[model samples]
Target chain A: MNNALADKALWDLRPGEAATVTGFGDALSVSYQGRVMEFGFQPGTRVQCLLNPGFGAPRVYGISNSVFSLDKEIAAAVFVTTRPPQEASS
Target chain B: MRRVLLLGSPNSGKSSLFNRLTGLSQRVANYPGITVDVASGPMVNLPDTELVDFPGTYSLEPISGEEAIAVSFLNEALADDHVSHVLCVADATRLEKCLHFILQVIRECQHHQKPVTILANMSDVIRDNQLQFDPAGLAAALGVPVISVSAKESQGFEPLVECPAEGAAPATPPSRNWRETPNEILRGTAQQLAAQFSPKGDVLINSQLRLDRFFLSTALGGLAFFFIMFLFFQSIFTWSAPVMDAVEALVSGLGEAVVPLIPNRVIADFVADALFGGVGAFLVFVPQIFVLTLVIGIMEDSGYLARAALICHRPLRVFGLTGKSFIPLLSGVACAIPAIYAARSVDSPRQRMMTYLAIPLMPCSARLPVYALLIATFISNDTILFGLVGWQGLALFFIYFFGMLVALLVTGLVSKASKNKHSEQPFVLELPPYRLPTAKPLLRNAWNRCRQFVTQAGKIILAVTMVVWVLGYFPNGGADLGESWLGTLGQFVEPVFAPLGLDWRYGIAILTSFLAREVFVGTLGTIFGIEGSEENMLPLVDHIQASGLPLGSGIALLVFFAVALQCVSTVVILAREGSTRLALSMLLSYLVGAYLLSLIAFQIVSLLF
Candidate 1:
């Protein structure tokens, strides 16, 4: 864990690196096996980029947050996330 | 309903993406304390999935209005249970700068563990680029399936609609944190991007500019604004004249045709003086007003207007306002009604109120007739220059110049009077590539705005004109109006204006304008007792000139109209928006402004001419 943190601090934020999760939440907690693939279009999935759709647009939910119907259709798609830059493993 | 949230960086075609996603379903409003509009709409992507587009921003920790709305909307939706999916839209042309917003959203989603999709808009722009960045490679790096599409051409839409998008995880889906992965290293992103894709491409996605760009943008914006304004005003006359003339002819024809049909002289005269003379004359100006609104709408839609606000930032900041005040002020030049409503975009309540307080100082369309009449009548064709340029040209120029100046002065004075805190802000503008205003939306808007003006004139201008006509029409003991009590009333008031060098007929015209300035023409037309012709308009000018009304009076009248709080509709708007106190203050301030400016203008012109 300490090595991962040091490496995380050392290596430039790149496409592929392995480190233990810290500050876990429903936002980026997608089920993954090979470098974390996403199961998108599910009801309980929480999205960070879409919280409040302004005016009349639909709102997206982060996991644990209830799903909103901006429209009626429901399908899950995949998105990938990486550790935030400048943070180190402990 | 399934929700689709659109995200992007400033000027990265976010708004255009929204326009594409939402089309005519778009509506604009503000998140609290933000000047940028947070617009949303549903996309019929899948059978039941909805699309919700958010405001464009630089980072999630939104500072300005656009960013605030973006950040706030996301944060708010995360706390709520409504939204299903998030779509991170990035501009392919400026892909790197857009990454910060994407990364920030990623962080937030990590914090919440929600899966989001990235829609790389302007894919068409990238498709045509000399340097191509691998979308699949970038998508692999982020771990989310990245969909490349151009909204304009509807490319990649079927894939987008057919592709899976869901907020909740499927049963037994990978829910591990992103940090456990090997690709999660965080160093050298920009340098790698530069080495890998930038030279052949242009990547500095996460960057800002020196202050000089803002100033340059402002200067260019000001020049462009004036040039566009000139075109706008030119179009108002050139395009709307035919329609205005036709309406005038039709109304006059109706009044004349009805005169012989209706036997009673009073009824016939009332029909002529009140309905046709008053309403018809005011409605004649509607074409010009409608054409002006269309130009404004086009300017706004094409996105050059945002640059004007950005360029106007420092000047606007001087008045304790945001650049947001610029559009409202411009809107006031057309009419204060929508202009005041436009004030809702201001983040600070104080700034919004200040805008409302000051917008009326900008001369509106109601004052246009007064200005046109004065300029056409009193301005000489002769060119007198200070060195080599014409003084009259300078004078005509100063008419618009002074109106804006008076607005600034009012803003300053009102800012001083109010105890509101004003923080200085820089203008963040997105200059959308200019496009021709399309026919359907443009014409629909023009017609809607034009219809309102005609209707209002039908209601108010006609009523007031009729009242003024009746007051001037039937003299005491049924004596001749131009010769009896009405003439006597006009004469009594005539001397009061003599100080400014106007005759009683001018006095009568001014009195009629208490209803509306446009009514001044119809009032004079009726009081001159001329019928079925615009021919007498020239004679009325002749009579004013022939009456020995000094150049000073003409100048004074113009100045007063320029500064005066003569617009009743504006007053009503102020009262409704703020309070009676604000309304009264507006009235008092304009009255003072008009008197002082007129006094100065009349004195100067009297000495010169």
Candidate 2:
């Protein structure tokens, strides 16, 4: 996949897909950005989408050996570059 | 005296470790942010040393009010001269995230010139998964003492207990780089250290994900959540019925055995009418409090509460609340004071306010005696499902559900009416791994909560009972209670409740209950005891039935108790936690709303029956 196609919001990844966190989106406030980072969502961190409870509910993501449930809006503010399917599977 | 500050990320088993080291039960649970306040206790072996447990936080930079409290107190404690050691607890299974926090603490401790030691908790969990964690290697790498301990099994506590006495070394000096951000540097360091020392494998996360697939799924999760809530209310009545009845029997039996021995009629009347009849009626419901606390403790310990919060988020958002509010709302079932304290965990101030509005409406245990007495009088104890369920228990369930429903509706309307429709707060909740709740700590917590209820509320109930007894007994010497001082006062308030088809006796009970919800039961017990012509004591439920109270009035009483903000402690707590204006408005509005709603309920029930 092209780099443009791989770069998207953290919420865009499906379960079993992996991504490397690039940076935060502009929509997240300065304070919330700090909070997201403090929760171990720094650049270069690997995040895996774990569970997606349907109907736009918060989805679970695994980061730094801890699981966190983030709603759609917050998840969208976290920008990540999705790895290719083969690489994610590996 | 020297002091040790116990600190860590939320759900790292920090408070539990503190309890083990200090031999104090300070309410540890599986859920994060359980300890809202700083609790200090003396170390078991070192009598002169104190161990202080701060509220859990993910970072020195706080996101919520509770974390802010932990951070602020940490700064103050580090500055205090009496502070001798800093113990940072980290989860062995999730060391990367914990190490991030540990690194922050080390930075702070180093600046303060205080010694730091890391307690890697949950050793048993890693061992169970056959995972390896080299604490010695981590200690060598981090340049601080790393002690492996299990708060659950009480293992490796000897080293932990003696760390302060041995005077563990401070962390290695910080090597700063002027270019990069400190957080980024710390994060990078934590990532590397955790990769080397943390338990290898994805066993824990994989297991948690398997459970989440079921508990957080759409259709099945909702069904399971409702079923668990139904069982919660059902068990409160079903499990405590035998214990409640035993308490009732003991009180009356003791009254029978002891009251007659007093030669003076005045003292005997005081003992029987006030002590046994009044306070004893409230005491009968203490077991129900135990059961309520026990059930909540179980849910909190099993780690299903966070999943329940996640499940509740979408629906709760409709009412301008978040899934995080679910914890405090559920804790409201046990008591509103702690529930208000728990609201600190909710990040959004607006949603926290909405949670505060909803908490007082949750059917608390204080209202249990009133509901149980009313239900026992009005609803028949018919058995169904092979006696696994009772009609009375089902009635209790509906009352609880009704309160929660009304709370949501009120928040929905208020949120819709309020301005600022676009300021949405983020909802990021951590899902702690599920663990089987141990029976010992749960039972001990339940027992301690029961004892607290008896001691804290007991004094108020006893005082109110005495005042009511004296007011009703004087002038006529118990011959005619209707002409006594309490009777006159009740008559003055009779007009207020007359619309709901209730008499002055119920009026007085409702009025006195404003002091505390359980005092309603005791107040009614005293009035009924004085009004009864027989010498032997009868159960309050029987007294209600024999008094010829209308069905509409009984239903109205239930509605009133369900809606009213009767507890003064809840009001004081709201004032302390939020604002005095919020507390007073809630108190007045709920009082009027309870009256009007109960009147409507009486009219509807009267028309139906």
Candidate 3:
């Protein structure tokens, strides 16, 4: 995947895919910004899309080997660059 | 004594490592925030050295009270002269994030001149996935000794024990130029370490995603969650019955055999009826506690519990409780005491308080015997609805359901009343990768929880039983208990309960139940002119049934027990967790609410009967 074209928000990734976190965008609720950061969601982090419970529930993501179930609202605000399936190593 | 402290980010396998080293099971699990207090034990290898396990945290910012405890304890230890080394545990599978916390620890250890070692845990996972982690490479990069160990598999601990005390300590801490944005600095450093130390592809993520597909599927996930919950609660009843029977038989047979060994009539009756009957009643429930804890431990350690919490979030949110509240609330079914302790995991005070309000009404195992005895007394044992359900079993389900309903309703009302118009706590939780729960730690944890319950609550129960025994035994000397000192007290409270068709005997039982709910059955057995051993439950029920007591009164008592905050231990915990006022107000409101509701139900049932 081309790095320039690959940059997309976290919610853009499908389940079973992986990505590198670019940066946390400001679209997330103010209350969750501190928490998302505290939980290791930041630029240069590697994350994989784990699960999205249907009916618009929070999407679960694996970042830095820790699983975090993020609300779709918050997931949409986290920016990332989608990595190719084979090279998506932490 | 020199102290070797085990430190790590939450859920980073620190407690498991501590347990492996110390041989003391200090509550290790997959979920974060299990250890809320400091635990110290003598190391097995270095017997002269003490090992301490601290609560987990992501950063030193200390967002919650438990995190504050961990950070402050570490700060204090850094200033202490006797502390020898700090062992930082990092998950090998998640080294990037673990490195961030390890870097912070390195900085602090450098400042204090204390030796530090990094234990990269979960090496078994790395090995299983055919991935390699260069612990030596990372260790070289940081100027610290890093040992690869799998606490679960019990591998790679020899080097840890043989680790030298005079090992490398960095001459200086990392530069603080990037301290303003700690995550950025940590992230950059973590990225560098990951590139050099870890393998080229993710393995666990794929397996975890495949598992989550089925477990977190909307339709199937909800069904699985409920199925597991039902099995757990059912097992508590079905699995415990035989053991309860055995305990009952031993106590009753001992009472019959041993009372004659005493010559004096008064002492004989005391030994046979009071001591054996009263205490044995509480002991019968021990097996059930074991089952409840074991099931919960499995669910928690296997990583299925987080999914249950996720599934419960939307539904529970409607009642103003976050998904995080589910563990404590479900745990409340076993015992409210630990459930209250588990509520500390909730970051939001408002949500936690709401959970606390809902907990007491969860129809704990303490109330099981009381419900069983009462239902058996009045309801027919035969199956109903063309053998679809037993009347007694349905009654049990309804009683539990009734309590849960009231808990949710109260939480909803209180959430509305509370003044948290702003700052809703987000439910961003780690959905830990599924693993086969190791039974060694799970059973050990369950055993510890059971032991804790027996030691802590048993003291109170035994004391209350003996007091009630003494109150009824003396003055008239075990003859005509209605004329005893307890009788006078019972009469004083009798008027308060007369509206529900109960006499002073039942009134006294109700009062004693305030100490603990299961005591109600024993108290009733004593008052009904029989030994209070569960072996005599049938006889006690027969006595009440033969007395022509109104059906409405039996149902009313069940209702009262369901809603009342009768357990003293729960009240004490509530006070400690929240405030004395909250506990007192909860007690007063529930007491009044239960009485009024029971009274109304009794009147309605009486008119129909």
Question: In Å, what is the interface RMSD of model 1?
Answer: 16.8
DockQ, per-model, please?
0.02, 0.59, 0.41
Worst 10 residues of 3 chain B by lDDT: B170-179
Can you tell me the CAPRI class of model 3?
Answer: acceptable
Those runs of model 1 whose alpha carbons end farther than 4 Å from true positions after fitting are A1-90, B1-10, B22-84, B100-116, B130-145, B159-200, B203-232, B243-368, B371-401, B412-422, B427-508, B511-515, B531-536, B542-554, B568-587, B599-609
Q: Residue B483: error of model 1 in Å? A: 14
Which candidate's TM-score is highest?
Answer: 3
Off by over 4 Å in 2: A1-6, A84-90, B23-37, B124-137, B152-159, B170-185, B188-200, B261-264, B327-353, B363-402, B415-424, B495-506, B512-561, B566-584, B598-609
The full ranking of all candidates by DockQ, starting with the best, is 2, 3, 1
lDDT of 3 by residue, B1-609 (tens): 778878898667887888889887344321233335567777777777777777777766555555666687688887888788889998888765567678778778767877788889998888888887887778778777788899998898886675523333333233333223454565467657765775556567667777788888988887877888888767776777798789888988988999889999988887876678767766666676677677777887788888877777777877889888998898798778778867876766678888989999998888988998999998999997899999899899999999999999999887777646353555777777787777776677667766766675677667766787788778989776677878788899899999999989898888878877877787788777687445558898888898877999999999999999998767876876677899999999999999998999899999998
lDDT of each: 0.56, 0.79, 0.77
DockQ for candidate 2: 0.59
- Give the C-alpha interface root-mean-square deviation per candidate: 16.8, 1.6, 2.5
Consecutive 10-residue window with the lowest summed lDDT within model 2 chain B: B172-181
C-alpha displacement of B206 in model 2, angstroms?
Answer: 1.5
CA lDDT, candidate 3, residue A85: 35
Q: Which stretches of candidate 3 lie over 4 Å from their true place?
A: A1-34, A44-46, A55-57, A72-90, B24-35, B164-184, B191-198, B248-274, B334-352, B365-369, B372-397, B419-423, B515-555, B568-585, B603-609
